[model samples]
Target chain A: MTEAAGTAGPAGSAGAAGVDGPGRPGPRRGRVLEGLRAYGLIAAMWIRSTMAYRTSFVLMTVANFAMTVLDFVAILLMFSQVDALGGWSLAEVAFLYGVSGVSFGLADLAVGSMERLGRRVRDGTLDTLLVRPVPVLAQMAADRFALRRLGRVTQGVLVLVYALVLLDVDWTVAKVLLMPVMLLSGAGIFCAVFVAAAAFQFVAQDASEVANAFTYGGTTMLQYPPTVFAQDLVRGATFVVPLAFVNWLPAGYVLDRPFPLALPEWVAFTPPLVAVACCALAGLAWRAGLRSYRSTGS
Target chain B: MTDGDGAAAGGAAFIELDGVEKVFDVRRKTGFLKRERREVRAVDGLSFTVARGEMVGYIGPNGAGKSTTIKMLTGILTPSGGRLRVAGIDPSRERTRLAHRIGVVFGQRTTLWWDLPLIDSYRLMHRMYRIPDARYRENLDRCVELLQLAELLEVPVRQLSLGQRMRGDIAAALLHDPDVLYLDEPTIGLDVVSKAKVRGFLRDVNAERGTTVLLTTHDLQDIEQLCSRVMVIDHGRLMYDGPLAGLHEVGESERTLVVDLERELPPVEAPAPARVVRVEGPRQWLAFPASASAAGLVAAIAARYPLVDLSVREPDIEAVIAKMYAERASA
Candidate 1:
């Protein structure tokens, strides 16, 4: 192409220079970088999209923030009356709740596009994405980002900090460093569940709401001990869906409390594993779904 | 083994097919038996190809595999029986790789971010294509200037005029500077000026970049103005494949001549071999063969009545294509 050969200076020179590099993996690296750049570009577009309807966005976001805070206040009032249920204090319950909240908020940011994106796939609008040189997943991620969700994440951070101050927990350098790890892992776990719920859309005609169990249900379940439920169904859902690892299991470490199960102490330290395993499974499900993509009409 | 050498379904040739088929399973109910699956052959054993750098006008009434063929060529769809390849890579196999080299525009849609400004989409394309910063700026400047997108760049795409949006879509397709471009009705809903501008842009993109372009549209003017070769498809079959000149060559030459007479003419036939088309008031229109017999038809009309004025017109592409389709219909 003339443009490829036409550019001068650094960006062009770097590309040409890499053509004869000593080893391989160069082209793919370029694509990966392109993917990241594409995502950033669309995110900016999303911000502009929000800016277009500034008043509606601001009003709706404020309402959402108010509702989130209201829910937390309701939990606090209920706990004040009962003192403690399922062996968790008000502070401990809040800690688990905050972790789950923040994780789901981050997950919503990363993969929220998937929910409505399935419609694009069904309507054949995804043809625009499939023809691009970038990875479909990257294209899908950048396809459409809803910026108003930031309101929920802000609420999550507020509750998380409150729980940390109210609880009696020993904080160390390693634990502080691992805080980001826990957040990312928790996000990964929830994102996987959301994506899997979206994948069912490939087969279903309507928007698949099954992901609510893992996303909404999972978040609510993690706020307390998994064993608190009388039926094993809730416990099974937590382990199978790995809500325990992302929130409940991690809460055990932060609270330094014994779990209902007689498993070893180290077993409670498994947030990263559960998060990663759920993510890997979801990713595989996504690829399979693409193979079965039946683009409608032309 | 061939359309002469045996045509494969959709693999061996540049655009091949071997019983290339598609069956869509539509499920209306919830249970297993409630699901009803039916086979719709959008492209039933359809097969054809345009060699490198060839400009082919793929035509069909509608849903006769025109888009299906393009989609298969672009690797968006995998044929039930055949394989597809473009630029030496199986489109389905190297879909991501092929994307870098091919450009496509959907006539009824815009590939751009819906709510973003035109320039923003261009900037994102610069990133997606990894255009060097300098080159990005240079190409951006050129396309904006060429497409008259400067004023339109600041406005959001949702707020763009239809003509303006078509220009933006075309500019976006060429941003990466692809080797192949697919246009599905690129000029469907544009004004004459916008359509001409789009056609002109496509012609230059082909000539300047030697980009092999495959376009489908209902506008015959597009074919007349841009494409040197036209391929017509009807009912999922290649009805005609040749040059535009060939389409105009209808086995015999015909020209139309109109004359106004000062007085009514007596009953008279054409002097030599011309045939009278119609007569209204003082004017008479005649169809004459290309054998230089218009003078004879005129002299005969003049002999019967005093002539006021006369002129001859060459057959336009619209009439030529209509006649061609009609002849094909009866034959």
Candidate 2:
């Protein structure tokens, strides 16, 4: 698609379109819609770019699925040796594992690029995002959109569906409806943690591996019932990082299991609220990080 | 130029800075037990105004804070103190708002996605910037034809040559039709042909679009070919700001005259202002003030010796800068 642009000699000739009296500020579209469109376009471009190497992408996806399945295999092997661990049956723990796995995989799909913020900061490439006309957060999310994460998410959802069909619990309508909310809000919570981790890079000026302890480690911990953990460790995950709000508590409510640590039943429903608060706090930390970035650009 | 109005009084300033200062507090560990904190002033009291439609060159040695100033202008780094306004908007405070009006290219790094095809990056920009479809197409078509990038559009950025990637980056920056373009060392690692192509493209962009440009490059030829105004900074201070011609005079630079004599002889006795600095075989080299008229020296040498052929050489900017730095240090 080509049109003869003014093609005026190598000197200033005001082009009619694009250039005019005072730039016209390019049509002020609705901010949310603009962000969404830009994000979608970025993700599409990333997918296309990945698809360029179709075989590699496919292999990586398959490998991710296989690797995640091994986790379930290990759990199954352990369950074979014993009927139950910490009073929860193997099938019940699989539900917990599936929910946390899906939530984490989904969040990784959205915000995994935050994990590389340290490298971008160290190399000064983050400046490219800063110069663009979009929010840095949206740009960061778009910068690294991995389709391979879907493999793990698919594995997780499959495990979850299988667990649901086989479990003897009476499936309530509320349980069915809240399952999706749990997954989405759980993803939101993980995404918030990722953003908060990115904020740490501004101070460290390098990739902070510490964030993985919560993001990946929290998901691993949630794969088992909190009752299996030491009291202090369970409390920390529940109250300190609120990892329990992501899946364990919600899964407990759905499975009709008693809450660990003497928590009320309402806490299970607070994933959405907790997720929102976490997002707000992450946003504040992200802003503070940006401020520090602008001040001390290292 | 079509931008004669911008040069006149009462014209709107496209970029303005007043006493801008950026001080970095660096903490270094002296040992396991002790550390030291010191404030390194990167840019101190930097003040300049760029008029609309002006293509200006910003030059400085390493660590002279050229990149820091560019960062501040782009709002990537905020100044420690002072006020800065680009198109009447404070850059750091209204960075996202200002982003729509400005385009930046960092020659050392790319803004393009690494794995995407060259055209894919441009396509992403079309949406990211919300560029009108018609405008995006027109700009892309122009850049492709002018940059000779049609064959490279489908190539992944990682596979592209540095020069090709640089051209792609320039095209990406312009697709949005930004009002101002900041190019930091745009020709840093490019070959001669690529440099010429880039310089010509920049000249066209500046002239046709009236995009106010502030170019920072180590390549003096980039400034010589494209910029009418040059600003030189040293030690976070404006050492010189004027025409490229005036830089040699400020640096107290000396031009060399290479004369081919018919035969090897003793050092040729030239006039008072010009003296033979080197003699080898039939070639005699003389040093003269860069500001002095070379015509008289040529005539004087021609009369004194059997001059086979003679060529006047402008002082290379590298030597000019070295001399300037030496003088600045001694002062």
Instruction: Indicate which candidate wins on lDDT.
Output: 2
Listed in order, each prediction's TM-score against the native is 0.81, 0.92
TM-score (second chain) of model 1: 0.79
Off by over 4 Å in 2: A1-30, B1-10
Q: Top TM-score: which candidate number? A: 2
- Model 2 CA lDDT for position B160: 92
- Per-residue CA lDDT of model 1 for B199-271, tens digit only, reads 8878877887777888998888788788888877655566667887676565354778888878666434666
Q: What's the true lDDT of residue A175 in model 2?
A: 88
Worst 10 residues of 1 chain B by lDDT: B1-10
Candidate 1 segments exceeding 4 Å error: A1-34, A52-57, A85-87, A170-179, A224-230, A257-264, A294-298, B1-33, B133-138, B245-331
Give the Cα error of residue B246 in candidate 1, in Å: 4.1
i-RMSD of all predictions: 11.7, 11.1
Instruction: Output the lDDT of residue A186, model 2.
Output: 94
**On residues B1-331, what C-alpha lDDT tens digit does candidate 2 reach at each position?**
2221223223567788899999999999999979899999999999999999999999999999999999999878878998787776556755665677799999988988788789888988887777889999999999999898999999889999999999999999999898899999999889999999999999998889999999999899999999999998998999888999998888788899999999998998888888889989999899999889999989988888898998999889878878888889998
DockQ of each: 0.26, 0.33
Winning candidate number (DockQ): 2
Cα lDDT tens digits, model 2, A131-232, are 876667777777768899899899999989878877987778988888999999999999998989888888885556788888888899999988889999
